[model samples]
Target: MATYDLIVVGAGALGAFHAYHAAKAGQRVLLLEKDQYPIGATVRNFGQVVPSGLAGRWFEYGRRSLEIYRDIQSQTDLTVRANGTVYIASDSDEWVLANELYDRYQAIGYPCELLSKLQCLTKYPLLQPDYVVGGLFFPDELSVEPEQMIHRLIAFAQKKYGVDYRPGSVVVDCQSNYGGAILTLANKQRFQAGRVLICSGHEVRLLFPEQLADAGLVVSKLQMLLVEPVAGVTLPGNMLTGLTIRRYESFQECPSYASIPKPEHLAELQKWGIHILFKQAIDGSFIVGDSHEYADATKAEDLGFHTQDYINQLMLTEARRIVTFPLEVRKTWAGFYSQTKAEIFEYDVDENIRIITGIGGKGMSSGAGYAEASIREMGL
Candidate 1:
């Protein structure tokens, strides 16, 4: 058996970050992925690294993740662009919540600006004038190319940090003991390590299905779209509409969050759990998404991995209403992540085995920081 300091499963954003942190700390880590490369929720959603939207420990982690990103990028070629983010409000109701969040940011002395209708349009001229009343511009937020960031991160870890990355390996059997854990791969290969960190998102069942099930793990499905870029289109950063205010937990910290005004005209949209966000990819093509649905976490794949036309129609309709770009759905798909009622579901099954997944949609936003903290707290 090849022994190492730590073993990581999943190889997604969370797993990759865990392995990266472990390796950076001088721990020899064996990072395993079931697929040849990760094609799960990690790469499927918008790569918006917005620390300003996270609160408490997660917010701190996000800041650390940014620092780490810069650290790694300085030593290597991984790129994290400072594109920033803007949350636009279409009417008085969304504007009410927007100001509430801005007030909280002002009180905390965060470097962010609340933009009036004129300023918002001046910044992002691409936006439809009638659709935006105001916006909150978070200049510190960063973004990455979601589809390629992990693959590049994995390469950086392996080349620069010497993290032993093993792709296309699935752990069929995992046995934990006081001294260490033994993982048996489907190909009958075995790896022994002092501890195991399971960051497997939906596949946590492959290792500890019982723990995941007992934790009441549910799957949150998101239907997303990538629209063909217009001949000439530009955005301030990632754009979050009024829907995100109700969806993201960070906004809850504002004193007026609980009592933020609600626009009754959007009742139907809210009923379907639809939210609109626009992010421009590195290639300049825009990514627009998304609608949410819930199902038994274990049955998410059985539900299908393709987009639902009805949901996409609803999403595109809303997207058009918010901004105009001669939008055409160049591509459509669905991604699912583990969801729980808690901030994040991280647990230790034993002295030598740990699990960290079920971060919901925040994985792309605050995941790296969360993983770094997890490694430090465990003294790994």
Candidate 2:
């Protein structure tokens, strides 16, 4: 049997981050994934890394993650797009809310600025004047091409840190032993590890069905889309809508929430219209999204494309207010994110076996920090 210090299931954002940290710590790590490449939530949505959307604690982690991302780019060949982010407000009320958030974030020493609609248009000529009343700009935010980022992270872990990866290997069974856990692969191959961290998002339940029953961890399906970018018009940076502020804990927890109009807040929740975040790929194509739908058993046929259309329309309407680019639909898809009632779900199924999941939808932004914390907790 192959033996290692740690075994990580799922090669998504959380899994990759955990594997990277474990190998960096000089632990023998094995990362197993059922797919040939990551086809999960990791690569399915906008790749914006917004520190502003996270809670205060997570925002701090995001700041650290951004630093790691910045340093890793020079060490690895991953394409890190650190263009920053702009939160656009469509109405006077939203502008008020944006100013309030800007003040709060600035008070916490976060780099953010409140800009008038005219200032935003002057700064980014592609912006449409009528759509934006004001904007919040975060100079430290960045984005990456999700596929390239994951591949590069995995390559760095293996080549530089000696992390072993078993792609296309599905873990069929897990048995806990005294010192560690034994994982049975689909091919009947067994691997032993001193510790096992289950970063496998929605697949966590399938691996430990009985244990997760009491955890209230369920699956949420999110629909997303990609749009062909306009030839001459390039977004100055990433963009977020005002609705996002209402949904994100960072904004909701802030005293700025008092500035948001009650009727507007209710309307947003009724439509589930959190802010729309947009990021342009290296090729200049923009990835847009997303709407959430929760379910216990999510199947291929159950995925919705019309939901993407609805979200796209909403985004375009908002985008028209900020920029004058003609967008053409390129592709639409859906991905599954694990949802837990709690902020994070960590449990010890056995003394040497641990499960870590429930990053919600903030995996890309906060996964690295959580992975580091998880590793420390495991003493690996």
Candidate 3:
């Protein structure tokens, strides 16, 4: 007998959400994670679930994620906070870009406010006054405590729907067997399921290295850090500055975004693909770098355990220029995730085994809804 209706590999946000939705729909689901718990890009990056910064179908997916997160919080008592997002414009060009984005947002009836310099300062006293020009505040965005989020969500899914979650067991081989799928663990243990999904993040090297290469999969390495605020300092919400306007794809919708030439410094920030965003924790600490480096899948094997010191320095240096918070580095780490030029990445090796991954930085922002829709379409 097929022991489980579905066996989902990887316990990151993507895998967890797949397990969640399948189990919620009354299937016998098993979620497998190699480590004791998920510690991949899911937990390592800023957990700012910002729909306002997403464009097209992804923005809709992010909106659905907001509702799902809210529902989970109410149903399971998990921590999904409504912190919102503030994108600041520090110069004329950036200010012009913000206005264009604001106009387009107003046309679409998106709930965003374009605040004047005085309004920004009045609302967020912690913002460095000298760096403020004007800003856009997206009132609908939300955030999650990343470090604790995945674990709690999986726990809730387990308790509410009887999801069989197995941690510390790594899948070494998976193949079709006996009209179903059989996954072999590192310890030679085997499990069967009618359907199997591999949501293994950038670690595609494990199952489908050849296929991932064909799909143009690349590894995006990011340098990130967490810092404690000066005693009693409080941030108004998730913070972004001019640097982000160029990085987030959603901002490209503004006509000015295309016409405005990047200033030397901003151009330099763009050259390295640095995205400086901030999300404040419930304890008042802040999560903040994110410098992007893309490695071809062929060289992804050489992609090693290294955090570029110069890149980290560049990130912290730029962060200081945007805001004046006394950010003492409490913890820092590098995060890795898979990305492709494709908007969505998923395929099937056979009818029974499917691969779903590579939504890039939107994993936390758009993952839940994407998973829900993909599962429905897969009919699994």
Candidate 4:
């Protein structure tokens, strides 16, 4: 039987980074994935690393994650791009929230630029002039090609750090022994490890159903679409709008957030949790999305696999109101992720086994830094 210092189940962003850090710390690490490649929230995301959208420790974690991502990119190509992020305001209420959040970021010494109406129009010509009142821009953020980034990161870790990575290896059982845990694969092959970390996303029912049922986790289904590349149009960075200004967590933390009246007309949009954001890919196509729908983790099936056309049209309707550019949908799909009332769900089944999942949308922005911190906290 082969033995390892750490066995990380699920090679998504969280698990892969944990394995990378463990190996970087000189521990023998094994990374396992059920599918031939990662096809979860890690890849099915907007790939926007905007710390500006988060608050508190998550915001700090996101800031650190940016640093870690750049460090890795320096060593190899991880599809990391420093294109920056901007939040555009359409009305006085949203405009107030933007300024308030700017003050909050300023107090913390984070760098951001407040743009005038003309500045916003000058920077992004595709934006409808009347739709944009002003904007706030964060220059240190990034946008990545989600489909390509994870594969490159895994390959880099294998070649440079000597981390053992196995795909299509499904773990059926994990039992703790005297000093370590034994992991049994679907084929009945077994491996031993000093500790096992499960960052398996929403697939927790397979390993520990009782804990997952009582963990208060909810699965969120999001709908996003890709626009076919538009000729003579260029959007360089993450473009967040008025709806986003009203919906993001950072804005909720602002002092004026409570007093700002919610528009009664937007009730249906709020019911579905729709927020419009745009990011132009290197290939000139635009990635736009998304709306949130929730169900208990146990009832994830309630949120079916089919994408809702009415929901997509609601998004496209609002999207058209915001931008003049053509939005011919190239593709549409649903992405699932888990979350809890707490920032993350971390349960220690025993000293040798821990289950960590339910990071919500913060995975892309904060996963790397949180994993590094978790390793030190675990003394692994």
Per-candidate Cα lDDT values, in order, are 0.84, 0.77, 0.85, 0.92
Which segments of model 4 are wrong by more than 4 Å? Answer: none
Per model, state how many residue pairs clash. Answer: 0, 6, 0, 0
At residue 109, what lDDT does model 1 achieve? 71
List the candidate numbers ranked by TM-score, top first: 4, 1, 3, 2
Off by over 4 Å in 1: none
lDDT of 3 by residue, 1-380 (tens): 33899999999999999999999999999999999999888998888888877888898888899889998999875568886889998888888888888888888787899999999988887778888999999887888888899999999999998989999989989899776899999998889999999998887677877887687777887788888867757775688888887767888887777787767876656766787888888888888877787887557656576877777777788788767777688877888888888876788999899998777888999999989997888786
Per-residue CA lDDT of model 2 for 245-289, tens digit only, reads: 556777676665766565653464337443566778888888766
By lDDT, rank the candidates, best first: 4, 3, 1, 2
Residue 331, candidate 3: C-alpha displacement in angstroms: 2.6
Model 3 spans with C-alpha error above 4 angstroms? 301-303
- Writing each residue's lDDT as its tens digit, candidate 4 over 33-93 gives 9999998999998989999999889999999999999999999999899989999999999
Alpha carbon deviation, residue 191, candidate 2 (Å): 0.3
Question: Which run of 10 residues does model 2 get worst, by summed lDDT?
Answer: 297-306
